[model samples]
Target: MKIKHLTRALILGALLSITGAMSSCEKQTQTQAQAQDGQYVKKGEGALSNVMLATIQSAAYTPTLPTKATIIESPSNVLSPRTENDNQNQINAAITNLSNSGGGTVLLGSGIFRIKSPIILKSNVRLKGGGQDVSIIKRDESWTNVEGRGMLESGGYIEDLTISDLSIDGNRPESYRMSNQFPLFGIEITIDNGGTTRNNRVYITNVKIVNTGMGCHIKHTNNVILKGNYIVGNGTLASSTHSLPTFFHNVYLRSIDKAWVYGTNYFKDSPGGNGLNITHLTNLTVEDNIMTGNNFRGIRLGGSSSIILVRGNTVSSNTDFGIGLAYDETGQPQNFSIIDNTVNNNDNNGIYIPNNTKNGEVQGNSLSGNSPLNIKKGTNLTNVSCQAN
Candidate 1:
């Protein structure tokens, strides 16, 4: 009789535990539903009266973090000739496998990997190749890039990612020639947070990208580095117009914060737009790069950029201005320093600054042989110094 009483007690305890678990799950579901009802808060730096003052006071932002410690399997045969008809599936499978195992590296071997779809990138992963020209990623003959996606496109909110030592021939002329489709891009990453939150810590080094709309088009990111890359001959629409559309660019950055772009060689850039275009950005340092033979401006900066330092670069022989800073009604560009650059032989002005810009300095630059006027500025400049050009 005592044993029978103990069994009944055990059964009663089990039922109570299950009922409590159900209640806990119901509360969790309700919390999730509430959060999904437009209540998710994006992270950001809190309110600041003076933006530049806040930038000066805050600690430096760094993005060289590797999230995982384990080394997952590296599929060297992801897109080799052996994986011919199953290139997309094999590549996705490898990436998914690595992601499921808590994020790792995708080691692409030396081969021409052809794909018909965009390769999704995950956070905490390094996509490495066998040095620059060994691993080439090209689009297949039957490929049609839906929604104007890039050859290597990153999804939402990725961080601690590095892509190095590869060549991406995005929709090369032969492939697009057959399909008559334009607007192909190489290495496009976008994160939409409206300046509330920025995707962090992306480094693309020693990569070569060519034959696309733009070599690198990044938006709303933080602490990015584009170093030692060769980007060329973008805006591949066979046109002879001097004024290419502004949307086409070789290296386009928008709404970026804290970027370091250096040692990039952009040749014959953007049959449609500028070689390097920066807009709505802050704390950008562009140095030691060569931008030549572009169809449009060599480097164009506008859209309320702030704290930009353009130094020690060569910009020459473009269809339009060498380095241009235009007016933006939303907010004028502040603390723009054009120093120690070689700006020569462009079709339009060299270092053209429009009205309403503030606290600018153009010093120690070598400007010669530019059309219209070299170092032209509007009369409404405030506290700006243009010396020794």
Candidate 2:
């Protein structure tokens, strides 16, 4: 019958050419997961110059966040001159005599304690110190750039606070800004009427914050727990001079609802902003942290943040964008979970999921030479369910 119908039309044209090449490779992987619009490729933008970007544009403090978190609502700590010494009047009279004889623990000894101010804290209290390199709290080279809030500072709506070990030396930043406060951090939990106030169960352990402008600013905190701490924040003599650059940070959570930055060690990085700049957060959990060499961005979950979880981190060589779901002070930006990270060689773009970021989940990351390891500008109505990154 005509050679058996020419062998059934050559096996139906090789099964319709393998179903149109597997549906054109699933529509070219959903158009490369939304990457278009010139695929956001600008490789690198580091080693800031231009006089370090004009000392970060001579800080008109244009929204690189931070500093709405004021202190001095007077739960304690605000004896102004930034806390006039005698080690801040014997640690604010031992944390107001163990929080009015209700709470306890204020033991702090073992050398150097020349504080220039801020050691006020209350609510349950428990500011133990001894060895995080022998309890040193230096900071009083005639305290310049000193406004107030941190070197250990606090305000209203307090909770069961606990700051252990200790080794703060925020000997930097604020090289200016006075009257309108904001320029100081080394554990500054806030309040003083800048609105939003929660402040609950805060616990920071094995502390060791150095050269600071910011090394912890837990604002509007709630169930916060930054364990195994050891921030460097911005060194190199305040990032080669001024540019408190994008408002300093080695940790600057804001409007936080729940947090747990585990195994922290954002050391030797942050020439200024971001090494963990979290904002308007919710159920956050940044585990196994070790955010590396930053100049800006080594883990910055933006304002409209959602159920976030950046796991097994080691966001390397930051020059910006190693882990950024950034952009927003409100709305969009949802369930993120950049997993098994080791976002390597970041000169830029190891992970930069922007564009209406929705149900995100970039998996098993161990990306290499990140001038571009992943930059999914989400669509398909903000999917972002990528795999084996």
How many steric clashes between backbone atoms does each model show? 0, 2
Model 1, CA-based lDDT:
0.69
Task: Please write out the lDDT profile of model 2 over residues 1-389, one tens digit for every residue.
Answer: 98667656754654454344323311111211122233332335321111111000111111211112112222333222223445867777868876787766777777667776677887787777776978678788776656545778885678887878768877664442211233567778877566555777788789888776677887776778777878875522232244344356778787877787777555548665678888788778787888888776788888776777777888888887888877664764577777777777777677787666667666556677777544535444355555434
Give the clashing pairs for model 1. none
The lDDT values for all models are 0.69, 0.65
**For this target, which candidate reaches the highest TM-score against the unseen true structure?**
1
Q: Residue 204 in candidate 2 has what lDDT?
A: 79
Q: Which candidate is the best by lDDT?
A: 1
Worst 10 residues of 2 by lDDT: 49-58
List TM-score per model, in order: 0.75, 0.35
Tens-digit per-residue lDDT, 14-100, candidate 1: 445434432321111111111122232233432211122100011122213222222334434434533563465666676667766
